[model samples]
Target: MPVWGWILIAVIVVIAVVAVIVARLVSSRQRTERLRGRFGPEYERTVGEVGNLDAAEDELAARERKREKLDIVSLPPEARAKYADSWRTVQIEFVDNPSSAVGAADRLVIQVMRERGYPIDDFDQRAADISVDHPKVVENYRRAHSIYLAQEQGDVGTEDQREAFVHYRALFEQLLETDENKDKPKETRA
Candidate 1:
Protein backbone atom coordinates (compact mmCIF):
# COMPACT_ATOMS: atom_id res chain seq x y z
CA MET A 1 0.00 0.00 0.00
CA PRO A 2 1.01 3.63 -0.57
CA VAL A 3 2.52 5.55 2.36
CA TRP A 4 -0.43 7.96 2.58
CA GLY A 5 -2.93 5.09 2.50
CA TRP A 6 -1.10 3.28 5.31
CA ILE A 7 -1.03 6.44 7.41
CA LEU A 8 -4.75 6.98 6.90
CA ILE A 9 -5.57 3.40 7.91
CA ALA A 10 -3.39 3.67 11.03
CA VAL A 11 -5.08 6.89 12.08
CA ILE A 12 -8.55 5.36 11.66
CA VAL A 13 -7.59 2.33 13.70
CA VAL A 14 -6.23 4.52 16.47
CA ILE A 15 -9.37 6.59 16.57
CA ALA A 16 -11.55 3.51 16.76
CA VAL A 17 -9.49 2.06 19.58
CA VAL A 18 -9.55 5.33 21.51
CA ALA A 19 -13.27 5.64 21.13
CA VAL A 20 -13.87 2.13 22.43
CA ILE A 21 -11.64 2.76 25.42
CA VAL A 22 -13.41 5.99 26.30
CA ALA A 23 -16.80 4.37 26.07
CA ARG A 24 -15.74 1.50 28.28
CA LEU A 25 -14.26 3.84 30.86
CA VAL A 26 -17.37 5.94 31.06
CA SER A 27 -19.58 2.88 31.36
CA SER A 28 -17.40 1.45 34.11
CA ARG A 29 -17.34 4.75 36.01
CA GLN A 30 -21.12 4.98 36.04
CA ARG A 31 -21.40 1.42 37.33
CA THR A 32 -18.80 2.03 40.02
CA GLU A 33 -20.59 5.13 41.28
CA ARG A 34 -23.89 3.27 41.53
CA LEU A 35 -22.24 0.37 43.36
CA ARG A 36 -20.39 2.66 45.75
CA GLY A 37 -23.70 4.11 46.83
CA ARG A 38 -25.08 0.68 47.73
CA PHE A 39 -22.17 -1.25 49.32
CA GLY A 40 -22.50 -0.02 52.88
CA PRO A 41 -26.25 -0.46 53.02
CA GLU A 42 -26.08 -3.99 51.53
CA TYR A 43 -23.46 -5.06 54.04
CA GLU A 44 -25.55 -3.64 56.83
CA ARG A 45 -28.68 -5.40 55.61
CA THR A 46 -26.84 -8.71 55.37
CA VAL A 47 -25.61 -8.35 58.91
CA GLY A 48 -29.08 -7.69 60.26
CA GLU A 49 -30.65 -10.58 58.32
CA VAL A 50 -28.06 -13.20 59.22
CA GLY A 51 -28.44 -12.31 62.86
CA ASN A 52 -31.98 -13.64 62.43
CA LEU A 53 -32.24 -16.55 59.95
CA ASP A 54 -36.03 -17.02 60.02
CA ALA A 55 -36.72 -13.44 59.18
CA ALA A 56 -34.19 -13.51 56.38
CA GLU A 57 -35.91 -16.54 54.79
CA ASP A 58 -39.28 -14.84 54.83
CA GLU A 59 -37.89 -11.68 53.29
CA LEU A 60 -36.25 -13.70 50.49
CA ALA A 61 -39.53 -15.40 49.62
CA ALA A 62 -41.34 -12.11 49.30
CA ARG A 63 -38.67 -10.63 47.06
CA GLU A 64 -38.69 -13.74 44.84
CA ARG A 65 -42.41 -13.47 44.18
CA LYS A 66 -42.18 -9.74 43.60
CA ARG A 67 -39.33 -10.17 41.16
CA GLU A 68 -41.05 -12.97 39.29
CA LYS A 69 -44.36 -11.17 39.13
CA LEU A 70 -42.72 -8.03 37.82
CA ASP A 71 -40.89 -10.07 35.15
CA ILE A 72 -37.86 -7.92 35.71
CA VAL A 73 -36.04 -10.36 37.95
CA SER A 74 -35.15 -13.26 35.65
CA LEU A 75 -32.00 -14.72 37.02
CA PRO A 76 -31.57 -18.47 36.85
CA PRO A 77 -31.96 -20.32 40.11
CA GLU A 78 -28.18 -20.56 40.23
CA ALA A 79 -27.76 -16.85 39.80
CA ARG A 80 -30.47 -16.14 42.34
CA ALA A 81 -28.70 -18.48 44.69
CA LYS A 82 -25.54 -16.59 43.99
CA TYR A 83 -27.26 -13.41 45.03
CA ALA A 84 -28.88 -14.98 48.09
CA ASP A 85 -25.70 -16.75 49.00
CA SER A 86 -23.82 -13.53 48.58
CA TRP A 87 -26.19 -11.83 51.00
CA ARG A 88 -25.78 -14.71 53.39
CA THR A 89 -22.03 -14.44 53.04
CA VAL A 90 -22.34 -10.77 53.70
CA GLN A 91 -24.20 -11.80 56.83
CA ILE A 92 -21.53 -14.25 57.89
CA GLU A 93 -18.05 -13.90 56.40
CA PHE A 94 -16.24 -17.20 56.03
CA VAL A 95 -13.36 -18.44 53.79
CA ASP A 96 -15.51 -20.36 51.31
CA ASN A 97 -16.49 -18.07 48.38
CA PRO A 98 -16.85 -14.55 47.08
CA SER A 99 -19.81 -12.21 47.53
CA SER A 100 -22.44 -11.44 44.91
CA ALA A 101 -22.31 -7.70 45.00
CA VAL A 102 -25.04 -6.09 42.94
CA GLY A 103 -26.12 -2.46 42.97
CA ALA A 104 -29.80 -3.27 42.47
CA ALA A 105 -29.97 -5.37 45.64
CA ASP A 106 -28.54 -2.51 47.62
CA ARG A 107 -30.92 0.04 46.14
CA LEU A 108 -33.94 -2.21 46.54
CA VAL A 109 -33.15 -2.92 50.17
CA ILE A 110 -32.68 0.78 50.86
CA GLN A 111 -35.89 1.80 49.15
CA VAL A 112 -37.90 -0.91 50.87
CA MET A 113 -36.51 0.01 54.25
CA ARG A 114 -37.17 3.68 53.67
CA GLU A 115 -40.76 2.99 52.68
CA ARG A 116 -41.18 0.93 55.84
CA GLY A 117 -39.80 3.78 57.97
CA TYR A 118 -36.41 2.20 58.55
CA PRO A 119 -33.81 4.70 59.69
CA ILE A 120 -30.88 4.26 57.34
CA ASP A 121 -27.83 6.23 58.28
CA ASP A 122 -24.44 6.49 56.65
CA PHE A 123 -21.79 4.02 57.79
CA ASP A 124 -20.57 6.26 60.55
CA GLN A 125 -21.99 6.69 64.08
CA ARG A 126 -23.42 10.12 63.37
CA ALA A 127 -25.72 8.55 60.80
CA ALA A 128 -28.19 6.92 63.23
CA ASP A 129 -28.22 5.09 66.51
CA ILE A 130 -30.67 2.41 65.49
CA SER A 131 -31.78 -0.47 67.68
CA VAL A 132 -33.08 -3.91 66.55
CA ASP A 133 -36.38 -3.41 68.31
CA HIS A 134 -37.00 -0.26 66.27
CA PRO A 135 -39.91 -0.56 63.85
CA LYS A 136 -37.65 -0.01 60.86
CA VAL A 137 -35.22 -2.66 61.98
CA VAL A 138 -38.01 -5.19 62.37
CA GLU A 139 -39.23 -4.46 58.89
CA ASN A 140 -35.74 -4.82 57.44
CA TYR A 141 -35.17 -8.11 59.24
CA ARG A 142 -38.36 -9.51 57.77
CA ARG A 143 -37.34 -8.47 54.28
CA ALA A 144 -33.91 -10.03 54.52
CA HIS A 145 -35.27 -13.14 56.16
CA SER A 146 -37.50 -13.93 53.18
CA ILE A 147 -34.83 -13.26 50.58
CA TYR A 148 -32.39 -15.60 52.30
CA LEU A 149 -34.87 -18.50 52.23
CA ALA A 150 -35.55 -18.13 48.53
CA GLN A 151 -31.83 -18.62 47.94
CA GLU A 152 -31.59 -21.92 49.78
CA GLN A 153 -32.91 -23.89 46.79
CA GLY A 154 -30.34 -22.60 44.32
CA ASP A 155 -28.09 -25.05 42.46
CA VAL A 156 -24.37 -24.60 42.20
CA GLY A 157 -22.06 -25.49 39.28
CA THR A 158 -19.91 -28.56 39.59
CA GLU A 159 -16.74 -26.55 40.12
CA ASP A 160 -17.68 -22.89 40.00
CA GLN A 161 -20.88 -23.52 41.91
CA ARG A 162 -19.05 -24.76 44.92
CA GLU A 163 -16.73 -21.80 44.73
CA ALA A 164 -19.64 -19.44 44.35
CA PHE A 165 -21.39 -20.93 47.36
CA VAL A 166 -18.20 -20.72 49.30
CA HIS A 167 -17.76 -17.13 48.27
CA TYR A 168 -21.28 -16.32 49.35
CA ARG A 169 -20.64 -17.92 52.71
CA ALA A 170 -17.39 -16.03 53.04
CA LEU A 171 -19.04 -12.77 52.16
CA PHE A 172 -21.61 -13.16 54.93
CA GLU A 173 -19.01 -14.11 57.48
CA GLN A 174 -16.89 -11.19 56.43
CA LEU A 175 -19.81 -8.87 56.92
CA LEU A 176 -20.14 -10.05 60.50
CA GLU A 177 -16.63 -8.80 61.22
CA THR A 178 -17.66 -5.30 60.25
CA ASP A 179 -21.31 -5.72 61.12
CA GLU A 180 -22.67 -2.30 61.91
CA ASN A 181 -25.83 -4.03 63.08
CA LYS A 182 -23.80 -5.45 65.94
CA ASP A 183 -23.68 -2.00 67.40
CA LYS A 184 -27.44 -2.08 67.70
CA PRO A 185 -28.99 -3.92 70.64
CA LYS A 186 -31.07 -7.00 69.76
CA GLU A 187 -34.62 -6.49 70.94
CA THR A 188 -36.45 -9.63 69.73
CA ARG A 189 -33.33 -11.84 69.60
CA ALA A 190 -34.57 -13.46 66.40
Candidate 2:
Protein backbone atom coordinates (compact mmCIF):
# COMPACT_ATOMS: atom_id res chain seq x y z
CA MET A 1 0.00 0.00 0.00
CA PRO A 2 1.17 3.57 -0.68
CA VAL A 3 2.28 5.66 2.35
CA TRP A 4 -0.30 8.33 1.49
CA GLY A 5 -3.07 5.74 1.44
CA TRP A 6 -1.92 4.33 4.81
CA ILE A 7 -1.85 7.83 6.35
CA LEU A 8 -5.31 8.58 5.00
CA ILE A 9 -6.69 5.42 6.57
CA ALA A 10 -5.07 6.26 9.93
CA VAL A 11 -6.61 9.75 9.92
CA ILE A 12 -10.02 8.36 9.10
CA VAL A 13 -9.78 5.87 11.97
CA VAL A 14 -8.74 8.59 14.40
CA ILE A 15 -11.64 10.78 13.34
CA ALA A 16 -14.13 7.94 13.82
CA VAL A 17 -12.78 7.17 17.28
CA VAL A 18 -12.92 10.82 18.31
CA ALA A 19 -16.46 11.17 17.05
CA VAL A 20 -17.57 8.12 19.04
CA ILE A 21 -15.90 9.41 22.18
CA VAL A 22 -17.52 12.80 21.84
CA ALA A 23 -20.92 11.30 21.23
CA ARG A 24 -20.66 9.07 24.30
CA LEU A 25 -19.56 11.96 26.47
CA VAL A 26 -22.42 14.15 25.31
CA SER A 27 -24.96 11.39 25.89
CA SER A 28 -23.66 10.77 29.42
CA ARG A 29 -23.80 14.44 30.32
CA GLN A 30 -27.34 14.75 29.01
CA ARG A 31 -28.43 11.74 31.04
CA THR A 32 -26.96 13.21 34.20
CA GLU A 33 -28.62 16.55 33.53
CA ARG A 34 -31.95 14.92 32.85
CA LEU A 35 -31.79 13.03 36.10
CA ARG A 36 -30.87 16.15 38.02
CA GLY A 37 -33.72 18.09 36.43
CA ARG A 38 -36.20 15.28 36.91
CA PHE A 39 -35.40 14.77 40.56
CA GLY A 40 -34.48 18.35 41.54
CA PRO A 41 -35.01 19.50 45.14
CA GLU A 42 -36.92 16.40 46.16
CA TYR A 43 -33.90 14.28 45.39
CA GLU A 44 -31.65 16.39 47.57
CA ARG A 45 -34.14 16.38 50.41
CA THR A 46 -34.55 12.61 50.19
CA VAL A 47 -30.79 12.12 50.28
CA GLY A 48 -30.65 14.34 53.36
CA GLU A 49 -33.24 12.33 55.28
CA VAL A 50 -30.97 10.55 57.75
CA GLY A 51 -33.87 9.18 59.74
CA ASN A 52 -35.05 7.09 56.79
CA LEU A 53 -31.62 5.52 56.38
CA ASP A 54 -31.39 4.69 60.05
CA ALA A 55 -34.89 3.26 60.07
CA ALA A 56 -34.22 1.09 56.99
CA GLU A 57 -30.99 -0.21 58.50
CA ASP A 58 -32.68 -1.06 61.78
CA GLU A 59 -35.56 -2.79 60.03
CA LEU A 60 -33.22 -4.89 57.92
CA ALA A 61 -31.45 -6.02 61.05
CA ALA A 62 -34.76 -6.86 62.72
CA ARG A 63 -35.81 -8.90 59.69
CA GLU A 64 -32.65 -10.96 59.94
CA ARG A 65 -33.47 -11.67 63.57
CA LYS A 66 -37.07 -12.53 62.79
CA ARG A 67 -36.01 -14.85 60.00
CA GLU A 68 -33.93 -16.73 62.53
CA LYS A 69 -36.97 -17.18 64.77
CA LEU A 70 -39.65 -18.13 62.23
CA ASP A 71 -41.10 -21.54 62.86
CA ILE A 72 -40.27 -24.08 60.21
CA VAL A 73 -43.55 -25.14 58.69
CA SER A 74 -43.99 -28.35 56.71
CA LEU A 75 -44.94 -28.41 53.06
CA PRO A 76 -47.36 -30.94 51.64
CA PRO A 77 -46.51 -34.47 52.79
CA GLU A 78 -45.28 -35.52 49.36
CA ALA A 79 -43.04 -32.47 48.99
CA ARG A 80 -42.17 -31.83 52.64
CA ALA A 81 -38.79 -33.54 52.62
CA LYS A 82 -37.55 -31.77 49.50
CA TYR A 83 -39.10 -28.38 50.20
CA ALA A 84 -38.83 -28.04 53.97
CA ASP A 85 -35.54 -26.17 54.02
CA SER A 86 -36.31 -24.54 50.68
CA TRP A 87 -39.28 -22.69 52.14
CA ARG A 88 -37.22 -21.50 55.07
CA THR A 89 -34.45 -20.23 52.84
CA VAL A 90 -36.94 -18.40 50.61
CA GLN A 91 -38.50 -16.73 53.64
CA ILE A 92 -35.07 -15.76 54.90
CA GLU A 93 -34.29 -14.30 51.51
CA PHE A 94 -37.47 -12.22 51.40
CA VAL A 95 -39.37 -14.82 49.34
CA ASP A 96 -36.71 -14.70 46.64
CA ASN A 97 -38.21 -11.46 45.36
CA PRO A 98 -36.02 -8.37 45.26
CA SER A 99 -39.10 -6.17 44.90
CA SER A 100 -40.49 -7.72 48.06
CA ALA A 101 -37.30 -6.78 49.85
CA VAL A 102 -37.75 -3.16 48.85
CA GLY A 103 -41.37 -3.20 49.96
CA ALA A 104 -40.43 -4.86 53.23
CA ALA A 105 -37.72 -2.31 53.82
CA ASP A 106 -40.11 0.57 53.13
CA ARG A 107 -42.82 -0.94 55.33
CA LEU A 108 -40.32 -1.47 58.11
CA VAL A 109 -39.30 2.17 58.01
CA ILE A 110 -42.92 3.26 58.09
CA GLN A 111 -43.68 0.96 61.01
CA VAL A 112 -40.72 2.21 63.00
CA MET A 113 -41.64 5.80 62.22
CA ARG A 114 -45.23 5.19 63.27
CA GLU A 115 -44.14 3.55 66.50
CA ARG A 116 -42.08 6.64 67.14
CA GLY A 117 -45.40 8.55 66.89
CA TYR A 118 -45.09 9.58 63.27
CA PRO A 119 -48.22 10.44 61.33
CA ILE A 120 -47.76 7.62 58.87
CA ASP A 121 -50.98 7.06 56.96
CA ASP A 122 -52.49 4.38 54.76
CA PHE A 123 -50.45 3.54 51.66
CA ASP A 124 -53.61 3.38 49.55
CA GLN A 125 -54.82 6.81 50.51
CA ARG A 126 -51.43 8.31 49.99
CA ALA A 127 -51.33 6.87 46.47
CA ALA A 128 -54.75 8.34 45.75
CA ASP A 129 -53.69 11.66 47.17
CA ILE A 130 -50.79 11.66 44.76
CA SER A 131 -53.20 10.74 41.92
CA VAL A 132 -51.16 7.69 41.13
CA ASP A 133 -52.46 4.64 42.96
CA HIS A 134 -54.89 4.06 45.78
CA PRO A 135 -51.90 2.87 47.81
CA LYS A 136 -49.47 5.56 46.82
CA VAL A 137 -46.57 4.54 48.99
CA VAL A 138 -46.70 0.87 48.10
CA GLU A 139 -47.32 1.69 44.45
CA ASN A 140 -44.27 3.92 44.39
CA TYR A 141 -42.33 1.34 46.30
CA ARG A 142 -43.24 -1.38 43.81
CA ARG A 143 -42.37 0.77 40.82
CA ALA A 144 -38.95 1.56 42.22
CA HIS A 145 -38.53 -1.98 43.43
CA SER A 146 -39.39 -3.36 40.00
CA ILE A 147 -36.79 -1.11 38.40
CA TYR A 148 -34.17 -2.36 40.82
CA LEU A 149 -35.18 -5.93 40.11
CA ALA A 150 -35.09 -5.38 36.35
CA GLN A 151 -31.65 -3.89 36.68
CA GLU A 152 -30.51 -6.83 38.76
CA GLN A 153 -31.94 -9.34 36.29
CA GLY A 154 -30.25 -7.59 33.34
CA ASP A 155 -33.65 -7.03 31.80
CA VAL A 156 -33.00 -3.35 31.08
CA GLY A 157 -30.21 -0.84 30.75
CA THR A 158 -28.69 0.08 34.11
CA GLU A 159 -28.56 3.85 33.57
CA ASP A 160 -32.24 4.36 32.81
CA GLN A 161 -33.61 1.91 35.38
CA ARG A 162 -31.13 3.07 38.02
CA GLU A 163 -32.24 6.65 37.56
CA ALA A 164 -35.85 5.57 38.01
CA PHE A 165 -35.08 3.38 41.01
CA VAL A 166 -33.23 6.14 42.80
CA HIS A 167 -35.93 8.67 42.05
CA TYR A 168 -38.83 6.60 43.44
CA ARG A 169 -36.81 5.37 46.39
CA ALA A 170 -36.08 8.95 47.32
CA LEU A 171 -39.71 9.91 47.01
CA PHE A 172 -40.86 7.12 49.30
CA GLU A 173 -38.07 7.73 51.74
CA GLN A 174 -39.04 11.38 51.93
CA LEU A 175 -42.66 10.44 52.50
CA LEU A 176 -41.62 8.36 55.48
CA GLU A 177 -39.41 11.13 56.73
CA THR A 178 -42.16 13.67 56.33
CA ASP A 179 -44.53 11.42 58.23
CA GLU A 180 -41.96 11.09 60.99
CA ASN A 181 -41.23 14.80 61.08
CA LYS A 182 -44.91 15.54 61.46
CA ASP A 183 -44.94 13.53 64.67
CA LYS A 184 -42.01 15.32 66.32
CA PRO A 185 -42.73 16.65 69.78
CA LYS A 186 -43.25 20.39 70.04
CA GLU A 187 -40.86 22.48 72.18
CA THR A 188 -42.25 23.38 75.61
CA ARG A 189 -41.88 26.98 76.91
CA ALA A 190 -39.66 27.30 79.96
Candidate 3:
Protein backbone atom coordinates (compact mmCIF):
# COMPACT_ATOMS: atom_id res chain seq x y z
CA MET A 1 0.00 0.00 0.00
CA PRO A 2 1.05 3.62 -0.40
CA VAL A 3 2.37 5.59 2.59
CA TRP A 4 -0.85 7.66 2.83
CA GLY A 5 -2.95 4.48 2.77
CA TRP A 6 -0.82 2.99 5.57
CA ILE A 7 -1.25 6.14 7.66
CA LEU A 8 -4.99 6.11 7.12
CA ILE A 9 -5.23 2.47 8.24
CA ALA A 10 -3.22 3.22 11.38
CA VAL A 11 -5.52 6.14 12.28
CA ILE A 12 -8.62 3.97 11.74
CA VAL A 13 -7.27 1.26 14.04
CA VAL A 14 -6.46 3.79 16.75
CA ILE A 15 -9.94 5.27 16.52
CA ALA A 16 -11.54 1.86 16.84
CA VAL A 17 -9.43 1.03 19.91
CA VAL A 18 -10.32 4.32 21.57
CA ALA A 19 -13.99 3.81 20.84
CA VAL A 20 -13.94 0.35 22.38
CA ILE A 21 -12.24 1.62 25.52
CA VAL A 22 -14.71 4.47 25.90
CA ALA A 23 -17.65 2.14 25.39
CA ARG A 24 -16.35 -0.28 28.01
CA LEU A 25 -15.81 2.51 30.50
CA VAL A 26 -19.29 3.86 29.94
CA SER A 27 -20.78 0.41 30.40
CA SER A 28 -18.83 -0.15 33.62
CA ARG A 29 -19.93 3.20 35.02
CA GLN A 30 -23.56 2.48 34.20
CA ARG A 31 -23.41 -0.86 35.99
CA THR A 32 -21.91 0.78 39.04
CA GLU A 33 -24.66 3.38 39.14
CA ARG A 34 -27.36 0.73 38.80
CA LEU A 35 -25.92 -1.29 41.67
CA ARG A 36 -25.63 1.79 43.81
CA GLY A 37 -29.21 2.78 43.13
CA ARG A 38 -30.61 -0.69 43.83
CA PHE A 39 -28.54 -1.49 46.89
CA GLY A 40 -28.38 1.98 48.48
CA PRO A 41 -26.31 1.80 51.70
CA GLU A 42 -26.03 -1.91 51.29
CA TYR A 43 -23.83 -1.21 48.25
CA GLU A 44 -21.40 0.74 50.42
CA ARG A 45 -21.59 -1.89 53.15
CA THR A 46 -20.70 -4.70 50.76
CA VAL A 47 -17.87 -2.71 49.25
CA GLY A 48 -16.52 -2.03 52.72
CA GLU A 49 -16.77 -5.69 53.69
CA VAL A 50 -15.21 -7.00 50.47
CA GLY A 51 -12.51 -4.31 50.32
CA ASN A 52 -12.86 -3.87 46.55
CA LEU A 53 -15.43 -2.34 44.26
CA ASP A 54 -15.37 -5.11 41.65
CA ALA A 55 -15.70 -7.90 44.17
CA ALA A 56 -18.50 -6.12 45.98
CA GLU A 57 -20.34 -5.56 42.72
CA ASP A 58 -19.94 -9.21 41.80
CA GLU A 59 -21.29 -10.24 45.17
CA LEU A 60 -24.23 -7.90 44.86
CA ALA A 61 -24.94 -9.10 41.35
CA ALA A 62 -24.87 -12.66 42.60
CA ARG A 63 -27.39 -11.76 45.27
CA GLU A 64 -29.60 -10.22 42.62
CA ARG A 65 -29.35 -13.33 40.44
CA LYS A 66 -30.06 -15.62 43.35
CA ARG A 67 -33.07 -13.57 44.33
CA GLU A 68 -34.39 -13.69 40.80
CA LYS A 69 -34.46 -17.48 40.96
CA LEU A 70 -36.36 -17.61 44.21
CA ASP A 71 -40.17 -17.74 44.25
CA ILE A 72 -40.71 -14.62 46.40
CA VAL A 73 -44.44 -14.14 46.48
CA SER A 74 -46.50 -11.50 48.26
CA LEU A 75 -48.58 -12.26 51.33
CA PRO A 76 -52.32 -12.62 50.86
CA PRO A 77 -54.53 -9.96 52.47
CA GLU A 78 -55.80 -12.19 55.26
CA ALA A 79 -52.29 -13.45 55.99
CA ARG A 80 -50.93 -9.92 56.06
CA ALA A 81 -53.68 -8.78 58.44
CA LYS A 82 -52.99 -11.76 60.68
CA TYR A 83 -49.26 -11.03 60.76
CA ALA A 84 -49.92 -7.38 61.56
CA ASP A 85 -52.17 -8.39 64.43
CA SER A 86 -49.53 -10.74 65.73
CA TRP A 87 -46.93 -7.97 65.58
CA ARG A 88 -49.24 -5.68 67.54
CA THR A 89 -49.72 -8.36 70.18
CA VAL A 90 -45.97 -8.78 70.50
CA GLN A 91 -45.53 -5.04 70.92
CA ILE A 92 -48.19 -4.89 73.60
CA GLU A 93 -46.64 -7.81 75.47
CA PHE A 94 -43.34 -5.93 75.62
CA VAL A 95 -44.64 -4.01 78.65
CA ASP A 96 -44.91 -7.16 80.76
CA ASN A 97 -42.03 -9.31 79.39
CA PRO A 98 -39.54 -7.27 77.50
CA SER A 99 -37.12 -10.11 76.83
CA SER A 100 -39.80 -12.48 75.70
CA ALA A 101 -41.39 -9.74 73.63
CA VAL A 102 -38.10 -9.08 71.90
CA GLY A 103 -37.68 -12.76 71.20
CA ALA A 104 -41.20 -12.98 69.88
CA ALA A 105 -40.57 -9.93 67.68
CA ASP A 106 -37.51 -11.59 66.25
CA ARG A 107 -39.40 -14.79 65.53
CA LEU A 108 -42.31 -12.87 64.04
CA VAL A 109 -40.00 -11.02 61.67
CA ILE A 110 -38.58 -14.34 60.51
CA GLN A 111 -42.04 -15.80 60.18
CA VAL A 112 -43.15 -12.84 58.07
CA MET A 113 -40.03 -13.16 55.97
CA ARG A 114 -40.68 -16.85 55.49
CA GLU A 115 -44.34 -16.31 54.72
CA ARG A 116 -43.32 -13.79 52.09
CA GLY A 117 -41.15 -16.49 50.44
CA TYR A 118 -37.71 -15.76 51.90
CA PRO A 119 -35.55 -18.77 52.66
CA ILE A 120 -34.85 -19.08 56.41
CA ASP A 121 -32.24 -21.79 56.42
CA ASP A 122 -29.44 -19.27 57.15
CA PHE A 123 -29.56 -15.81 58.64
CA ASP A 124 -26.74 -14.26 56.65
CA GLN A 125 -27.98 -15.63 53.38
CA ARG A 126 -31.50 -14.52 54.15
CA ALA A 127 -30.28 -11.01 54.90
CA ALA A 128 -28.29 -10.92 51.68
CA ASP A 129 -31.32 -11.99 49.70
CA ILE A 130 -33.54 -9.52 51.47
CA SER A 131 -31.06 -6.76 50.75
CA VAL A 132 -31.74 -7.15 47.06
CA ASP A 133 -35.34 -6.02 47.55
CA HIS A 134 -35.25 -4.27 50.91
CA PRO A 135 -31.88 -2.58 51.01
CA LYS A 136 -32.80 0.04 53.58
CA VAL A 137 -34.12 -2.41 56.16
CA VAL A 138 -31.41 -5.05 55.74
CA GLU A 139 -29.17 -3.33 58.25
CA ASN A 140 -31.98 -3.36 60.77
CA TYR A 141 -32.37 -7.08 60.13
CA ARG A 142 -28.67 -7.59 60.75
CA ARG A 143 -28.72 -5.55 63.93
CA ALA A 144 -31.77 -7.41 65.13
CA HIS A 145 -30.11 -10.73 64.37
CA SER A 146 -27.00 -9.72 66.29
CA ILE A 147 -29.14 -8.82 69.27
CA TYR A 148 -30.92 -12.14 69.05
CA LEU A 149 -27.58 -13.93 69.06
CA ALA A 150 -26.49 -11.93 72.09
CA GLN A 151 -29.69 -12.82 73.85
CA GLU A 152 -29.11 -16.50 73.12
CA GLN A 153 -25.71 -16.16 74.82
CA GLY A 154 -27.42 -14.46 77.79
CA ASP A 155 -25.27 -11.38 77.37
CA VAL A 156 -28.00 -9.01 76.25
CA GLY A 157 -29.47 -6.43 78.66
CA THR A 158 -33.08 -5.38 78.74
CA GLU A 159 -32.16 -2.13 77.01
CA ASP A 160 -30.36 -4.00 74.24
CA GLN A 161 -33.34 -6.29 73.91
CA ARG A 162 -35.59 -3.29 73.56
CA GLU A 163 -33.30 -1.85 70.93
CA ALA A 164 -33.41 -5.16 69.12
CA PHE A 165 -37.16 -5.04 69.13
CA VAL A 166 -37.02 -1.57 67.63
CA HIS A 167 -34.67 -2.74 64.88
CA TYR A 168 -36.85 -5.75 64.19
CA ARG A 169 -39.85 -3.47 64.04
CA ALA A 170 -38.19 -1.32 61.43
CA LEU A 171 -37.70 -4.30 59.16
CA PHE A 172 -41.09 -5.74 60.02
CA GLU A 173 -42.86 -2.49 59.20
CA GLN A 174 -41.00 -2.29 55.93
CA LEU A 175 -41.98 -5.83 55.00
CA LEU A 176 -45.58 -5.14 55.88
CA GLU A 177 -45.63 -1.95 53.86
CA THR A 178 -44.09 -3.67 50.88
CA ASP A 179 -46.71 -6.40 50.99
CA GLU A 180 -49.55 -3.93 51.37
CA ASN A 181 -48.25 -1.77 48.58
CA LYS A 182 -48.06 -4.75 46.29
CA ASP A 183 -51.78 -5.17 46.68
CA LYS A 184 -52.51 -1.58 45.79
CA PRO A 185 -52.82 -0.16 42.31
CA LYS A 186 -49.77 1.75 41.13
CA GLU A 187 -51.77 4.97 40.75
CA THR A 188 -53.08 4.68 44.29
CA ARG A 189 -49.79 3.62 45.90
CA ALA A 190 -47.74 6.11 47.88
Using TM-score as the measure, the top candidate is 3
Per-residue accuracy of model 1 over 1-190 as CA lDDT, tens digit each: 8999999999999999999999998976664454334333542464475675345434433433443443222234454445455555443432233123222334334443343343446422111222221323333433333343344454332343333333323322222323444334233210
Q: Name the top lDDT candidate.
A: 3
lDDT of 3: 0.85
Error of 2 at 139 (Å): 18
As for candidate 3, its clashing pairs are none
Least well predicted 10-residue stretch by lDDT in candidate 1:
124-133
Report model 3's TM-score to 2 decimal places: 0.90
**Which one wins by lDDT: 1 or 2?**
2
Clashing pairs in 2: 123-135, 124-134, 124-135, 127-136
Residue-wise lDDT of candidate 3 within 19-92, one digit each (tens)?
Answer: 99999999999999999999999999999999999999999999999999999987887887899899889989
TM-score of 2: 0.28
